[model samples]
Each structure stands twice: as structure tokens, then as C-alpha cells.
Target: MASNRIRKSALPGFRFSIGFTILYLSLIVLIPLAGLVVKTAGLTFPQFWETVTSQRVLASYRVSLLTALFAALVNVVFGLVVAWVLVRYRFPGKKIIDGLVDIPFALPTAVAGIALTSIYAPNGWIGRLLDPLGIKVSYTPLGITVALIFIGVPFVVRTVQPVLQELEAEMEESAALLGAYRWRTFRKVLLPELVPPLITGFALAFARGIGEYGSVVFISGNMPLKTEITPLLIITKLEQYEYSQATAIALVLLIISFALLLLINTLQRWTNRRLRSA
Candidate 1:
């Protein structure tokens, strides 16, 4: 029996490692989420329903969701262009431009909000030009979308950059040799390879936009039923000591965000499978 003994794993720390992982997750993630659920559970079903579906709350939900969606979609288009430019071409000050792409990641959200508000306010530099054109950027839903776009751009750029870099330049050259136009080459040769990462980037940007707070707070003007976003509404509730109602709103947001992300991930998986099969 001693001679027949065998080791179960090549590494020795499995038990300790797994135990630590579970404990870390419970403390950092699971436990807090559980507390949120417990707090929200204090509300009766009808109360929770009315709290999350009130006219003001519903307006916030619409503003948050639609702005996030629009920002993510815009990022997908322009972020792809930015990634393509960084990867495909060499130009002067290229490094500076590339470094600037990460400014959002390093800049504080509050600073971003303040700076954006200043630049886009009614009497501010660019805003003065637009204001005369009857275009308002700050203190409106449009301003919220702009704030989200600023914060969310980096997510898309960073996510897609590596994938674009890994792509072979010769693929496009080969397509051109086969008589494909630039647009055709990109559509036929590059897009399939790029779709998965684009979806991932969209998901990341969209998720960030949804929970965004500081970056949006100043620009939005926080007008109830107009420029208000859900996260701000949650904060307002918490400030008023409406703990259960705040939790209920947060729970609804959490559930919807989770469902949307799950669907995006599923689509990504399906795309991967299709790519592999083809």
C-alpha cells in the first residue's frame, strides 16, 4: 500500500488556495451583495414596485439606460477607428495621441465632470459657439451622454487594441491583391475577427456608463424627471435616509445590468463558436 501511493496534483497549495479564494470572494463581493439584498428585502413587493417605477424613478432609468447605450454605440464606432489608427499607421506625435487615450483611466471622475462642465457650460469656450446655435451640452441629457462617452472611451480602446495589433497586416494586403476595395477588405477580412472584441468593449463601456456617478453628476444638472440619472437618484435616496427604497432601486438596476451583460456575453460566446466552426 505504501508503494502504491500517488500524488493527486502537481502543485501543493490547492486546499489552502481554494479556501483563501472563497473567503476573499465572500468578503469582497458576496457578503456586500447579500447585505444589499437583505436591506432591499425589507420592502413589500408593491412598495418595491412603486418605488422603482415612480414617474421620477422611471425617468432616471430611461435617462441612464439610453445614455449608456448611445455612448457605448458611439464608442464602438470611434473606438474601432482609434484602435485601427494606432495599430495601422505611424505618424508624428503618435505616442502623445496614444497616451492621451488613457487620460480617462487616470483622471479623477470628479475632475472630469468639473472640467467638462466648464468647457461646455452656456458661457464657456466651445459652449458659447454651440449655445448661439441653440445647442446645449451641459445641464441636460446630452451632457450626460457626453460625460459617459469621455469616461467610457478608454474601455473600448484598451479592450480592442491588443486584438487589432495581433491581426496580420497581410490579411488586408491579400484581400487587396484579390481585387477588394478598402471598405470591402475591412468588411470581409477584418470584421469577423474584430466582432468578438468589439462586443466585449461595448459591454465594458456600457457597464461603466450605467454605474457612472461623479463624471455625470455635474454635467447632468440633476433635474428630477429630466437630466437625473439612476445612480444620482440612488444617492439622493440614501441622503434622505430612504435606505430600503435606495436598495430597491439599486437592486432593480443590478438585475437589469446583469441580464444585459449576460446576454452580451452569450452573444460573444456564440460568435466565438461560429468563428471556430467556420
Candidate 2:
């Protein structure tokens, strides 16, 4: 029966595709991650614990996690607004603005880092205006967060835009006719439909932020125990020939990131189920 089912499959090159997919994932994803695990295995339990828990490493972890969370949160709110405007409104330069939303997707990360730093470097245009008011961006954690926000906005906007476009206008109109206020209608009606995709966008942005490096390093200034991020720390360790420690830190980040993403997925599933029930 199973053989017949396999033979009856219609997808082109099903077996070949499956085999190639697994092989490709192993070569591209599994192998490198396994290498990090294997390298970290060289450390004793105490050594591994000490390496990840060192004050400097801990500070980097805190900075990376917090900045990523803040950036992702910011993206959720503004990305939703941008997606809504792009989908529901027609105005001058709309196409141009929509295209600009994807700048982060196509522009090189180093170029993005340089552009962000140049504009926020205290001597630069916007930075100079804020500089006299005692606001500084470059070489600080706030600067890192700004860079992250810049890179992550596209993830949320792009993810949610399609979902919003597919949602029926009638549903919203019905809610209004039934006496639901705009705010309540959005909260109770549109929001339920959006929750799943929004969560997915949040998770993607968060994941990107956690792994971000080039842009962050330029703005963060890579100060130890201050604005350094985990990825930057990993690079610094690699530069100093501390492969074991680098891998150990990478493993921690991998585990934590996976765990958080899993949590978000769970929340999304639960929200979907509740929405269906309602």
C-alpha cells in the first residue's frame, strides 16, 4: 500500500526532491550548527557554563535580547500601520514609498550600517539636531536598537501586508453596522485575523535581530559589557582564535532563539484556535 501510494504521487521528482532537500539542509544548515555543537563539546561543563555566564558575555546576551525585543515590538506597531496604509490607501508617491519599505531586504547590510551610522553619528544631519539637545545615538545601545529597527521593519511590514490585503472589507463594515466602534471593531474583529501573521512577523524580526551583526557592530561600537551584541562577540572570539568559546556562545544563542521562536509559535497557534472558536 505504501509503495503504491509513493508510486502514485504526482509531484515531479518527488523522491529526488526529497533526497536533495535533506542533503541541502544538512550541508547548509545542519552541518554548521552541528560543528558549533561539536566544537563546544570540547569544553568541560564548568568551562562551558563559565564561558556563557561571564559578565561580559552575559552583558552581551542582555543587550542583544533586549534590543531585539524592543526592535521587534517597534516593528509590530509601525509595520502594521505601514502595511495598512499601503493596502487601503492610494496617494501620491505610494508606489515609491512601498518600494522603499523593502530597501533593507535588498541593500547590503554593510551599506545599511554605514548609512544608519552616518545619519545618526552626532555630527550628521539628524544626529546634529539632537546632539545639542543632549541626545546621542551612535556608539550606544540606543544606536544599536535603531539599526535593528531599521533592518527589521521590512520583515513585519512584508509579512503582514499580504494578510491584511486578503482580509474582507465586508467583515469590517458588518462590524460597524452592528454597532461596533472603529477601535472595538479593530480590536475584536480585524485584530483576531491579524494576530497569527503579526506573531509570525514579530518572531521573524526577533530572530533577525538576534543574529544581526554588521549593522549593529558599526553603531554599537562593540564596547565590551556595554553595547556589544552576541554576534559581534562571536566574531571577536573568532578573531582572537577562541573557537571553543565562540561556539559555546553561539550554541547558547541558538538554543535561546529556538526556544523563544517556539514560544511565539505556540502563542500564534493558541490565538488561531481562539479566533476559530469565536
Q: Give the Å shift of residue 211 in candidate 1.
A: 0.7
TM-score: model 2 vs. ground truth: 0.90
lDDT of 2 by residue, 121-144 (tens): 999988999899999999988899
Clashes within 3 Å, all models in order: 0, 0
Task: Give the deviation of candidate 2 from the true structure as CA RMSD.
Answer: 2.6
Candidate 2 lDDT (Cα, 0 to 1): 0.90
- Structure candidate 2, residue pairs in collision: none
Runs in model 1 deviating more than 4 A are: 1-10, 264-278
Show the lowest summed lDDT stretch of 10 residues, model 2.
269-278
Note the residue pairs that clash in candidate 1: none
TM-score of each: 0.90, 0.90
CA displacement after TM-score superposition, residue 157 of candidate 2 (Å)? 1.0
